[model samples]
Target: MSIQGSALPARPYRAFLFDMDGTLLNSIAAAERVWSTWAERHGLDVAAFLKTIHGARAIDTITRQALPGVDPEKEAQWITEAELDDVDGVVAIPGAVEFLNGLPGDQWALVTSAPKALALRRLQAAGIKPPAVLVTAEDVARGKPDPACYVLGALRLGVPVQDCLIFEDATVGIRAGEAAGADVMVVTSTHLTPMVTAHACIDGYEHIHVQRDSDGLLYLQRLAS
Candidate 1:
């Protein structure tokens, strides 16, 4: 699919919500290594497993894709521990650090499918600071495409869901953000295919600048198309 290079209309959004793995931090290699190894060990189909696992929670993927009778909790715990053990290749998405650092700390939050421990390690590996409000997989009963995590993030940030602008790299995450009533923007740093539904798609945060007005409304400006 061709890249969608349209402009996201300016809005007076009160908060920015971010997805960790692909949107803010590039962890494709590390994740692929972890999940594929788990899949191989369980004799599961690697192609199908990789396809659905990226955007959702490990437990959800295990229950849906892993073989029958597998203990979802145990499998999820193993994957989470494995991820934490090897965050060596994870790094900040281009422009992610600057863009995040520029925002008002309270006006932004990270809502990720990763468990809290794994999420914190990845952020540290990428040299990105965890936001004041972080909604992890453990924080919600359901994961992406469910909107539970995103909704919780908004509430924790003390902002209305409708007042949020979300940055996501997966279709499932986009669904969650939209369902949460926030305008979702896709980041192409991960998936390049035309598989996501979002207000706009950006290559990375490299060309985007963010600030807040006197009234605390976030001001977002894309320096390039």
Candidate 2:
């Protein structure tokens, strides 16, 4: 369960990009509540429905699962409202605060599938103040696995895509960052097992440390297991 033995070596980069839901915010409990009701209404297998929600737009997931002829955006909006109201179990991922504090504010940004409003609420509920540069679902024409969101995030941060590192916790987000030509690291907090393909896997920021060089590159190192 620890990154002590088989973790990746220390690395450096110009900027760090992060995903919200599974990466920084641990809101699976709230999310499951919303999605459970949605799946029930649509007569979908709950387990399969949950898997499709990760790292994807709510509209996209709902449209794909809802019965034919349903207004996907409308259904997605209903789910979003439910999610916004169900902030009961929202919490920040372990070590996320310290990790963000250690990095220069301008050197990092957030990219998420949630709309800006929902993203703000969740971040605030988790006590992670929204950063200056946040790329939400509304920011891009497409979501994860398309590379558009991650690519836009890097552009907003004024960093070259290849010079950025992505911290994500879902299969789709990993694929997105990879497609954007950036190194990706998966956080093991949500998925204790390392199943996703990434450059490396980490438990959380607890075992990881960050330092910035005069050249404006951040160095990330993992503690001894």
Candidate 3:
């Protein structure tokens, strides 16, 4: 990652694509509470399981576990219900509310591994409004690590995938954005330790600013440290 506070290039990005959980908001506390409980019930290592869960759909993760006698779909549904009931600690990442509010309503989209209702609940808890375009788990057959969500997000915004900038915080999401041919800005707000990546990274939206040209194209820049 470019940790020296490099400014984003002056490209004519037409839309901003954001991943919800760790990018726009912090829901780790609530998510871990439910997932850890589920992990313990399944006799899995809580910490390791938590690491694998982020940026993946519940069903996808559960299917990968291949827990004996457990139906992946049913287990995923249980996890979803638990998460929906537990948004107590959800809150916006620093400057997320202001940053999102400043964007033109139609110029951005939310693409998340979370289900639609859960996504809305978390956004509400974080004090961020739902975007004009939201591509949730229900909207796609596959989740992160698959570029479909990101591609669909850009399509819904009426922009070419290459003309969009994606904000993501996880490896799976970064891969998805890159595969969709969009520039990605890694958000490390939820990271517990430093990570090495090829894309430009930001800890939060506090120092980032957006500009719109006469033709309505958007540009992102970083305020000098």
Candidate 4:
């Protein structure tokens, strides 16, 4: 399905669950550069390989490739280290910092495929504060496309997964959020090509507003373009 610019529903979502790399910030350049180098080292097609890396754990991505003599765990660690050292082009998605800061600290969580250290480094580079409830690659046995991470994120925030809204920018993450029974909103800031998805999309958080009620429940409002 083609992406729709439809405003999200005005559900009284209890908490927000955000995907890090693309939804909260743009780290595409830094991430692709590191992955490209790794791909080249493994004699893999850089472009093709990069297409599969986003929204997935490094170890899972490497394990799927079945690269000869490559230890997925070790290679994943190397990738994480390289990513940690290369935050050159990382930047917040438009209005992301403000959007995040306005939310109640305990009412939001970050669910990311990047390991905790690398996730922290990228968030620092982008000027986004680390979320109180962070579910990183090491926190789950599986990654995006699997609901474990999102499930755990909502769990940690003390919210029911069904009462949370997930913001994501990749197919795998969208699927994960849906599988976890949360509503999904797509962030389109880093799209290299038009994305096709059934979820409502926002290019950035500039026009998205949040209001917290007296009961502390959150509601989202998107301004008309």
Highest TM-score, which number? 4
Q: What value does the lDDT take at residue 208 in candidate 2?
A: 80
TM-scores, all candidates, are 0.95, 0.93, 0.96, 0.97
Candidate 1 lDDT, tens digit per residue, 31-118?
9999999989989788887887888999998888647778999999999999999987899999999899898899999999999999
lDDT per residue as tens, model 2, 1-225: 324344654667989999999899888889988999988887889987787788888987776664887898898889888888888988888899888988888989999999888899999999997888999988887788889998888999899988898988888888999899998878768875547352677777888878788888898887667
Error (Å) of candidate 1 at residue 153 is 0.6
Tens-place lDDT per residue, model 4, 144-173, is 899999999988988799999999998899
Shift of residue 217 alpha carbon in model 2, Å: 0.8
TM-score of 1: 0.95
The alpha-carbon lDDT assigned to residue 127 of candidate 3 equals 95
Global Cα lDDT for candidate 1 = 0.87
Report the lDDT tens digits of candidate 3 across residue range 107-181.
999999998989999999999999889999999998889999999998898889999999999889999999998
Which pairs, if any, clash in model 1? Answer: none
Choose 1 or 3, whichever is better by lDDT: 3
**Clash number for every model?**
0, 0, 1, 0
lDDT of 3: 0.91
Candidate lDDT (C-alpha), each = 0.87, 0.84, 0.91, 0.91
Taking all chains together, the TM-score of candidate 2 against the true structure is: 0.93
